[model samples]
Target: MPMTVRSNCTGTLPSVIAGSAYTCSRCAEPHDGPPLGYGTPAPAYWNVEAADQPGSVLGEEQCVIAGSYFFVRARLVIPISDLDAEFDWGVWVSVSEASFERMSALWDKPERVEEPTYFGWLSTALPLYEPTTLNLKTKLHTQPIGDRPLVELEPTDHPLAVEQRTGITSARVQWIAEQILHTNPPMG
Candidate 1:
């Protein structure tokens, strides 16, 4: 069932104002979401644009948490000798330039400067209980994608000389790179 509203001359849902709300005409999905209660309203806060059909979230999905410690583990190239991966070793990832760009568009806000992490990496062939650091240098852009201030480093720089690091592997990186990017477009 389509919700009725005063659309604009363009025939699209016009921008709604304060106190505005939407609901299904037949079953009526009461619009009982959160954030604001009185002063303002919901739609403004619930600006999740639908894609495939309507009311779908995955359309702009980025990260799908897998409930595995691997995904959230502190991303750093801890050397195999230093780690306690007695029965652990896989890979890890969080966010980066490419990933952050897409996420920023949907979130429509700048990420906090103090955001815990900014990179990902792969784990060693073995598991460990504690983490270690790799002297093999890394980098972290002082700004977001469009270039603000980028920092560079050398192999000896390691943690002190690097900005942020991760545990991403060459294979996993290739797979993820393929998924996020598109290769072809149709002619109009």
Candidate 2:
């Protein structure tokens, strides 16, 4: 199932006060009016291979996560060394950029950042993971096609990467680039 809102929100789903609420644009249930008792923001927290280097970092992104669907805003890349033919590497977590900025300003205080609050990778044969839903889309070089991100895949690329790019829309990428990210959740 697509993610939903857990907070008991009031007013329109994305009210002027709190900006916009995140959800899986394709599969998420609509919040017609106020008092949103249950909803799911796209997975906001993620640990992924550093986009520029060897180490990993915790990052936030705007993306969708639902049964079978594993899309993220950032172009997630995993090193060939990290892939395994038989393993279910868990899920990556992330948040929106707005949330990241909010938390950054209040970084000095440990209690300031919130969970799922408002708010990369490297290597050759790198597999790029992009969002496939418009409502959950982020401002990236690649644009959205209908509800899915516009990404190109090559048949000769890494088998797993090819799989992620070609398999079911929601098929899980066996090699998760985000797991090696933050050893501990960022700002946790």
Overall lDDT per candidate, in order of appearance:
0.26, 0.27
Write the residue-wise lDDT of candidate 2 on 29-64 in tens digits. Answer: 332222112212223332232223333232332333
Off by over 4 Å in 2: 1-149, 168-178, 181-184
Q: How well is each residue in 65-135 modelled by candidate 1, as lDDT tens digits? A: 22221111111221113222111111122344454454345343356333433443321111111234222
Q: Which runs of model 1 end up more than 4 angstroms from their true locations?
A: 1-61, 69-92, 95-107, 111-119, 122-188
Which model scores highest in TM-score?
2
> What are the RMSDs of all candidates, in order?
21.9, 17.5
Highest lDDT scorer: 2
Candidate 2, lDDT over the whole model:
0.27
Give me the displacement of residue 40 in model 2, in angstroms: 22
Number of backbone collisions per candidate, in order? Answer: 14, 18
